[model samples]
Target chain A: MNILIIGAAGMIGSKLTNRLIADGNLGGKAIDKVILVDVVEPTAPADAPFATETMAADLSSPGVAATLVEKRADVIFHLAAIVSGEAEADFEKGYRINLDGTRFLFDAIQAADGYVPRVVFTSSIAVFGAPFPDAIPDEFHHTPLTSYGTQKAIGELILSDYTRRGFMDGIGIRLPTICVRPGKPNKAASGFFSSIIREPLAGQEVVLPVSEDVRHWHASPRSAINFLIHAATIDGEKVGTRRNLTMPGLSVTVGEQIEALRRVAGDNVVARIRREPDPVIMKIVEGWPRNFAPVRAPALGFRSETDFEQIIRAHIEDELGGTFVA
Target chain B: MNILIIGAAGMIGSKLTNRLIADGNLGGKAIDKVILVDVVEPTAPADAPFATETMAADLSSPGVAATLVEKRADVIFHLAAIVSGEAEADFEKGYRINLDGTRFLFDAIQAADGYVPRVVFTSSIAVFGAPFPDAIPDEFHHTPLTSYGTQKAIGELILSDYTRRGFMDGIGIRLPTICVRPGKPNKAASGFFSSIIREPLAGQEVVLPVSEDVRHWHASPRSAINFLIHAATIDGEKVGTRRNLTMPGLSVTVGEQIEALRRVAGDNVVARIRREPDPVIMKIVEGWPRNFAPVRAPALGFRSETDFEQIIRAHIEDELGGTFVA
Candidate 1:
C-alpha cells in the first residue's frame, strides 16, 4: 500500500515514480502513499492520486536509514549509488555510499521488529568482468574488475544473506546498461553507450569513444523499471536462496547499435555519432561484461527489449514523445 | 623477512607456525622475525631459531589492525575467524570478526605508505553452497547458505578487490574441510567430519551425525599449511586480478572415509564411531560443497592429499606420533 523510493531523483527512479503514479496501483493494490528520498530532493508530482512526501537525505550518514524506514513501507526500491567512474576515482566515498550505505539499510530493516518488506536492489551487470563466455551464464562467478562492480557484488551478497536469514524479502536485479537514457550525459564510463544514442537522436553530435566492434549488453529505461517492479512483486520462496539475478537484455556491438539506429530513425540520425577514440574509456570498457545468458531472471518473469531497434524505438516513444529530431 | 600470523592460537595456525619455525626460512630467505596474534595470547615456542612475539588482540577492535601493521611484516597470514557454528549462533559477532576485521586489516595496509605486504587469506569451501554440479568448476558462483559462509565469501571478494587495486599483494585460498584436525572436539558443525577420524584413532567414541552417503571435499592440515606458504610467496602478477583461488582437495563420502580409516587403523578404531544422527547438523552439512574441479590452484602449484587414507595417515604421523590406539 505504501512505498519508499530511495534515489528517486535519478533517471530510472524518476521514470519509475511517474509510471507507478500513472498506473495508480501495484500488484492489484491501490497505492495509498509514496515517499521519495534522495541526496537531492526529488521533484514531487503535482496532484497525484496518492499521498506524496519528498525528502533529501544521505543513507550513508549515521541514523539516516533507520529514521527513513520508520514509516514501514510495504516495498522499498534502493537505487542510490555513485556511478562507476566516480566510485573508481573516490575510493573511500564509493565504499561509504555504495557498500556501507546498503549494509546500513539492510541492518536497519533487520533491527526493526516484525517488519519484512519486499526490497528491490538495483545491482549491475558490471558484477561480471571481461574474458567472458559467449554469453555469461547465471552460474558464472563474480570477479568484478572495478571498484563499483565490487561494491555492487558485495551488495548482492549481503542482500541474499539477509533474505536467507528471513530479515527481509529482497531481490537484487543486475540491470543491463540502460540504452538511450533520457538526460544530459554524465561521467559514468557507460554513459557513452546511452549518450551516443540519446544525443544524436536530439540532433546533437556525440563522440563514440570505443571501437565499432566493441559489444555490450543493454536494455531501455522502461525495461529497467519493469525489472524493478517485477522484482518487488516476485515470490521470494520460489526464487530460492539465490536472490540476486542478471536481468536479460539485448547484446550487440557498437556497429550493430548504429545499424539499429539507422533502421529506426534513418542514416541521418545515425551519422551524428562521430568516431573519436579515447583510450582511457576504452581500457575501462574492456573489462565490462559483453553479454549474459541469464537463466534465472527470465524464468522469474523479468523481460526486456528483444533487439537494439526495439530499444531505440522505446526511447523515441517514451522520452521523445513519439518523435525524434529526424 | 618477517611474518605475521593472525589467529595463531588455532589448530592450523599453530601447525603453520611450527612448520615455519622448523624451516627457519621462507622462499629461500632466512626468517628474521615472527609475530603470532590471536584473541588470547598464543603459546610461544621455546628456543625458536628467530625472534617471536606472541600477543593477545582482537583485529576487529578499533585501532588494533592499524597498530598490528605498524611493523610492516613482509608476509601476513590472516587466518582469524570465528568457527561456522559460533558464527551462525552469534550473527553480529560473526560479521564483526570475519567481515569488518578483514576489511580493517586491508584498509590499514592501504593507509600505510609504501608498505605492501604479501597477504595470505584463508577462505573456505563454504563460499560455494549446495545444488552444485557433480564437480564444481573454477568459475562456480558463490551462494553461501550460512552466516559464516556469507562472511567468508565477502572476505574473498574484498581480498581480490584489494589485490587488484594494488593496495596489497593478496592471495585468498578457499580451503577444503581440514580432515583429521588435531584437537579436542569442538562445537563446529563440520567438527564431526574430523572427529570421526580423530577420536576413533584415540580410542574414543565419536558421533557420525550425517549419513554415510553424504560426500564432501577434504584436505589434510599439512596441505593447508603448504597452501598458505605457497600463496604467501607465489608470483602476484601470475595470479593476475583473480587473486582468490579454491585449493584442490580430495572428494570422498563418509562411507569412503570410514573405509580409509579401517584400512589405516584397523576395525577396532573404525568401530569407535557411533551412528547417532543429528538433524540440525545434517541440515547444515547438506548445503556444503561435495566436489570441485579447481583448475587454477593446482596449475599454480597448490596441492593437497590425494586420498582419504592419506588424510588419516597424516593425522597419525603428525598428531599421534606415528601410532594410534589400534
Candidate 2:
C-alpha cells in the first residue's frame, strides 16, 4: 500500500513517518511507497528500505493536495497545521492552511474516484474551550476559545461530513499537549510545559508563564504517533458516523509536572526554572480546558503514556539517545 | 443607527424587518435608517417612517457584502441561508451560500474603516446532532449530522473569531425549528411541522412524516424574530467573550404539536392530517436534537413562546388575522 504523510517535518509527523518506515507496514499492510510532504523538505530516514519521496510545497495551494494524492495512497496521515500561536497571530494564513488546506485535501480525495484512503487527521484538545467541568466529558460541546481551536473544530465537522458522504474514510484524532516535546523551544503558548523540563535539563533557565497550579492535558510524542497508527488501523465500523475521537492523556498541573521533573532529574535541574508570571498568557491559559474524559478513544483502543515519568523518559530516549546531558 | 437585514424577503427576515421598523429602536438605541437585502426585491413597508432601501442581489457574490456595508451599517442581521433540505441535496450550494456568504459578510464588515457593526447571525439548532440527552445544555458540542448544520457550525466559529479580534461585534443565536411557520409549504425538512398545522387549518391535506413520538425543539416565527432583535440589542458586556448563545425554545413532540393544533382548530382540522411514515425523513429527524437548555440567552433577556398552543395562536394572529378559512 502507498502511504502519504503531509506536514511530515513537524514533530508528530516526523516521528510517525520514522515509525512507519521502521515497521515497513501499518498493521500488516505492507507500504511499498511512502510520500512525505511538508512546507520544508523532511529529513529522510538514513536506512529506509521503502521507496520514500520527500516533497516540499505549500499544501494550501490549489491542486497541491490533488497532485499529492494522484497515485492513490491507501492511507493519508494529515498531521500538518499552523500551531496555536502562529494561527492566532496570522488569522488569514492559519485559516488558509488549516481550514482551506484540509478541505482541499478532502475534495481532492473525493475527486480521485473510488479511492477512499484511510485519512488519520490529527486534531488537538484545543478544540475544547474553558468554563469546562473538572474533566471535560466525551460528549462535551466544542466552544473553542481560540482561532486555532475553532479551525480544528471546523475541520472535525468537515471530516465527518465528507466521511458520511462516502467521499473518504476519515478519522480525526484530537491529541493532547505533547509533554517534553523534543527539540528547541517554539512559540506555542503551551511551549512552557516542555521548556520548563527541556531547557532546565540542559542547564538553561526557562520562564514559567503561569502559576504552578495551572493544569493542562498532556501526552508524549510517542503516544501521539501511536494514536495516528491506531487511528489508521482501527475498524471503521466501530467508529460509525462519528469520525472525530478525543485521545486519552494524562491531566496534570504545572506543579505536578515540575515535581515530576524534580523527581526524574534532581533539585538542581528544577532550580533552573524561573517563575515569571505574564497576565496575558495567564488569561489565555485560564480560559483553556485542563483535561478531557476521552472515554470513546480508550474504548476504541487508543492509549496514552502511563504517567509524566514515562513521557519524560520517552523524550530522553527518542531525542537524547536515552541520556540527558547536564 | 443604520441597520442592515440580509435575506430581507424570507419569512423570518421580513418579520424581523417589520418588527425593527415598528419598534423604531433596538435596546434603547433609535434606528436612523434600514437597508434590506435579499436575492429578490423585498416588499417595502406600505408606510415607512425611517429611511429604507431594498436591494436585490445574491450576498454570496464577491464584493456584494462589501458594497452593502460600504456606508457602515451600525447593526447587520445576517439571516440569509439555504434551508437544510436544499443544502443537503446540493452540498456545493450549501457551502457556497451559507459558508462563503457568511465569510464575505464578515470580511466586508472588517474592511469598513471605523465600522464595527453588531452582527446578529442567525444560526440553527441543526448545529447539534443526535444521541442528544433529554435536554442539551449550553455546553453541548456542535456535532451537526447534516451539511446544513455543518455550515452553520462553521459560521458560528467564524463569527466568534471575528468578534474576538474586534473585527465586528457579533453574536450567533442558534434558533430552534420555527413551528407553524406562516407560509405556503417550502422544501425544509422541518417544514412538515408547520405544514401539518398550517395546511390543515387552510383546509388542505398534510402528511405526517414521522410518528407522534418524534420530539424536537421549536419556537414560533415571532419568537425567532424576538431572538434576532434581542441578539442585536443586548449589551455585548452581558455576552462577554462567548459570542454565540443557544436561544430558548419549547421542546415539543409531533404528538404535542398535533394535539395543540387539534385544541386550537378542533379534531376536524387534526383529522385532515394523514400518517405516512417516511424512513428517510425519520432518519434525518432522528439525528436532530430534541431539546436545548439555553440558560444564557434567557438570562440576557431573550424570550420564546411558552407553549405549542401559544405558538399556534401566534401563527394564526400574525399570519391569518386570528381566523382560519376552514
Candidate 3:
C-alpha cells in the first residue's frame, strides 16, 4: 500500500508519520511507499522500511494539486490548513489555502481517471459557534463565528458532497483542541490551555489568560494520530453520506486541568501556574463550544482520553519520554 | 433607492420586479433605479416608475461581478442559480455558476470601498436533506444529498461570514418549493407539486408523480416575492450572526393539496388530477424535507400562506385573474 500525507510538517502530521513508520503497516497491509508534503519541506525518517519522499509545495497553486493527485496513493491524509489566528488575520490567504487549496485537491482527484483513495480530512470543533447547548449534540448546525471556522465548515460540506458523488472515499474528523501541546508556549488565544499544563510540569511559570471556570474541549496528540489512522482505515459504508464526524474529547475547565496536572506531578508544579486573566481571550473563548455529546465517532470505534488526567499523562509519556522536570 | 436583481427573468425575479415597480418604493424610500441581469437579456418594463436597465451577464466569469458591484445598489437581490436538475446533471457547470458565481459576487462586494448593500440571497429548502425530523428545527444540521444543495449551502455559509465581517448586510431566505408555478408543466421532479394544482385550473390533465400521502413544504410565488422584499428591508441587527433563516411555508400532503384544490375550483378541476406514480420521481422526492418549524423568519416579520387553500387562492388571484376554468 502507498500513502500520501499533505501538511506533513505540522505537529500532528510529524507524529502521525512517526506512528505509521513504527507500525510498518496500516490495516494489515504493508506500506510500500509514502509521500510527505507541506508548504515547507517535511523530513523523511531514515529508518522507514518503505521508500519515503518529502517536498515543499503550495497546494493553492493552480497545478500543484493535479501533480499530487497523479501519484494515485492508496490513502491520502489531508491535514493541511492555515491555523485559526493566521487565517482570521489574513482573509485572502485563508480562503486561498484553506478553501481554494482544498477545492483544487478535491477537483484534481475527481479529474483523475478511476483512481479513488481513502481521504482523511482534518476539520475542527471551531465549526460550532457560541450560545451552544450544555452539550452540543451530534447533529448541531454549523454557525461558525470565525473565518477559519467558516472555511472548515465549507470544507466539510465539500468533502461530504464529493464522497457522495463517488469521486473519493472521504472522512472528515472534527478534532477538539490539543492539550498539553508539546512545545514552547506561544501567544495564541488557545495557548493557555496547553501552557498551563506544559510549563508548570516543566518547572516554569505560565500565565493563565482566562479564568479558572473557562472550559474547552481537548484531546492528546497521541489520540489525534490514532484518530487519523482510524479514519484512514474505517469502513466508509458505515459512515454513510454524513462523512464528517466530531471526534470524542474530554471537556474540562482550567481549574480541572490544573488539578489534573497537580495530581500527576506535585504541588510545586501547580504553584507555577499564575492566574492573570485577559478579558480579550476570555471573550473569544466564550464563543467556543465547551462540550459535545458526540455519538457517531465513538460508535464508529474512534476513541480518546476519558478524563483530563489521562490527557496530561499521555502528554508526559509521549512528549517527555515518560519523564518530566520533577 | 437603487436596486439590482440578478436572474431578473426568472419567475420570482420577474414578480419581484413588477411588485417593486407597483409599490414605487421600498422601506419608505422612493425607488430611483433598477438594474436587471441574467444570462439572457431580461425584458425591461417600460412603464416602471424608476429607471430600468437590463443586461446579459454570466456572473461566474472573472471581472463580471466587479463591474456589477461597482454600481453599489442599495439593495441587491441575488436570485440566479442553475436549477436542481441542471446542477446535478452538469457538476462542473453547477459549481462554476452556483459556488464560484456567489463567491465572486461576495468578494467583489468586499473589495469595494465602504459599499455595504443589503444583499437578499435566495437560498432553498434543498439545503436540507431526508431522514429529517417530523418538523426540522432551526438548528438542524445541513446534510445536502445533491451537489446543487451543497453549492447553495456553501453560498449560505459565505453570505453569513461576509455579513458578519461587515462586507455586506446579507440575509439568506431558504424558500420552500414554489407551488402553482405559473408556467407550462416541465419534467423537473418537483414540477408535479405545482402542476397538480396549476394544470387542473387551466382545464388540462396533470400527472401526480408520487403517492397521495407524500408531504412537502411549499409557498406561493407571491409569497416568495414578499419574502424577498421583507428580507431586503428587515433589521439585520435582530438577525444576530445567524443570518440565514428557513422561511415560513405550508406543509401539506398531496391528498390535502388536492382537497384544497377541490375546495377552491370544485371537483371538475380536482378530477383532472391523474394518479400515475413514477418510482424514479418517488425515490428522488423521498430525500426531500417534508416539513419545517421555521422560527426565525416569522419572528423577523416575514410571512407566508398558512394553508394550501391560501396558496391556491393566491395563484388564482394573481395568475388566473381571480377565476379558474370551472
Question: Compared with the true structure, what per-residue lDDT tens digits does model 2 show for residues A123-180?
Answer: 9888887778999998887878778888899889999988988889999999888888
Name the candidate that leads on TM-score: 3
Q: Which stretches of candidate 3 lie over 4 Å from their true place?
A: none
**Model 1 Cα shift for residue A220 (angstroms):** 0.2
Chain A TM-score, structure 1: 0.97
Please provide, for model 2 over B238-275, each residue's C-alpha lDDT reduced to its tens digit, 9 standing for 90 to 100: 79877889999999889999999888889889999999
Model 2 TM-score relative to the real fold: 0.96
Model 2 local distance difference test score: 0.87
- Superposed by TM-score, candidate 3 places the C-alpha of residue B132 at a distance from the truth, in angstroms, of 0.6
> Per-residue lDDT for B27-136 in model 1, tens only?
88999999999999999999679999998999999899999999899999999999887888898999999999999999999999989999999998888877999999
True contacts kept of each: 0.90, 0.69, 0.87
TM-score of each: 0.98, 0.96, 0.99
lDDT of each: 0.91, 0.87, 0.93
lDDT of 3 by residue, B1-326 (tens): 89999999999889999999999999889999999999998999988999999989989999999999988899999999999999999999999999999999999999999999999999998888777999999999998999999999999999999998899999999999999899988989999999999999999998898999999999999999989999999989998999999999999999999999999889989999999999999999999999999998898998999999999999999999998898
- Give chain B TM-scores in order: 0.97, 0.96, 0.99
Q: Select the stronger candidate by lDDT from 1 and 3.
A: 3
C-alpha-based local distance difference test score of model 1: 0.91
Error of 2 at B98 (Å): 0.9
Name the 10 consecutive residues with the lowest summed lDDT in model 2 chain B: B182-191
